[model samples]
Target: MPSLRNYDLFISHAWKYNEEYYALENLLSSADMFKYRNYSVPIHDPVIDPNTKVGQEKLADLIEAQIRPVQCVLVIAGMYAAHRFWIDKEVAIAQSYNKPIIGVIPKGQLRVPESVKFAAHEMVRWNTDSIISAIRSRAL
Candidate 1:
C-alpha cells in the first residue's frame, strides 16, 4: 500500500473561504485512515493581505513555483471558486504542469463552479474515503 504522503499535492482555494479549506485540511490530516499519509501545501497559509498590491505576473510565478513540484492539485469546488481569478490561474498552472487536478465538492455545497468541473480530472465528495481514493487513483 502506498502512503498518501507519497503523492505531493497543492490545494487551490479562495482566501475568503479559508474556513472550509482548513476544515478539509484537518479532515485529511487527522483521519485515522490517513494517519501515516503525508499531505502538505507549499505555503502554510497563502493569504496575501488585501491591502497588499502584488504584480499579477509575480504572483503567478510564485504560485507556479509552489505548484511545480506537486503531483496533484486539489481544488475546493465551491461556487465562489469560479469567481476567484487566482484559483483559475492556479488550475491553469496545474494543467500546464501536467499535474492531476482533483475537484473536491465541499460538504453542503449546492453548486460547483464550471471552471472547477472543467479542470478536474476527478471529482470527489467531501469524505475521507472518497478524497483519499481520488488522490491515490489520480495522482501522478
Candidate 2:
C-alpha cells in the first residue's frame, strides 16, 4: 500500500469559484481519515490567477513545472471550469506530462463541465475516501 505522503497533487480551480477548491483543501487536510496524508499544493501555486497576461507558452511552462513533480492533477468539476482558458491549459499540461487527472465534483453539484469529464482519468464525489482512493489508485 502507498502511504498518503507518497501522493502529491496539483489542484486546478477557477478564482471566481473558489469555494469548491477551499472545501476540497479543507476536506483533505481536516478529515480524520486523511489526517496522516501529506497531500499539498505548492507554496506559490499560480493556478489561482485567472487573469494573467503571460504568453501561452510561458504559462504552460510555469504550470508544467508545478504539475511535473505531482502524482496527479485535481480539477474541480464545476461549470465555470469549462469556460476558463487557464483551466483548459492546465489540463492540457497535465496530460502532456502524463499525470493522472482526477475530476472532483463538488458537493451539491449535479452537472460538471464537459472539458473536465473529457480530461479526467477518473472522477470522484466530494468525499474523503473517494478522493483519496482516486488519487492513490489512478495517479501516476
Question: What are the lDDT figures for the candidates, one per model?
Answer: 0.79, 0.77
Q: Please provide, for model 2 over 1-140, each residue's C-alpha lDDT reduced to its tens digit, 9 standing for 90 to 100.
A: 66545467888866567777778887877755443322333344465343565555665676777778888899989889878987898898889889899999988989989999998999899889899888778867
**Candidate maximizing TM-score:** 1
| Model 1 poorest ten-residue lDDT run | 35-44
List TM-score per model, in order: 0.83, 0.80
RMSD of 1: 3.3
Q: List pairs with backbone clashes in candidate 1.
A: 5-38
Candidate 1 per-residue lDDT over residues 33-63, each given as its tens digit: 5432323343434454334566566677778
Model 1, runs deviating above 4 Å: 1-5, 33-54
Determine the backbone clash count of candidate 2. 0
Give the TM-score comparing model 1 with the true structure, all chains together.
Answer: 0.83
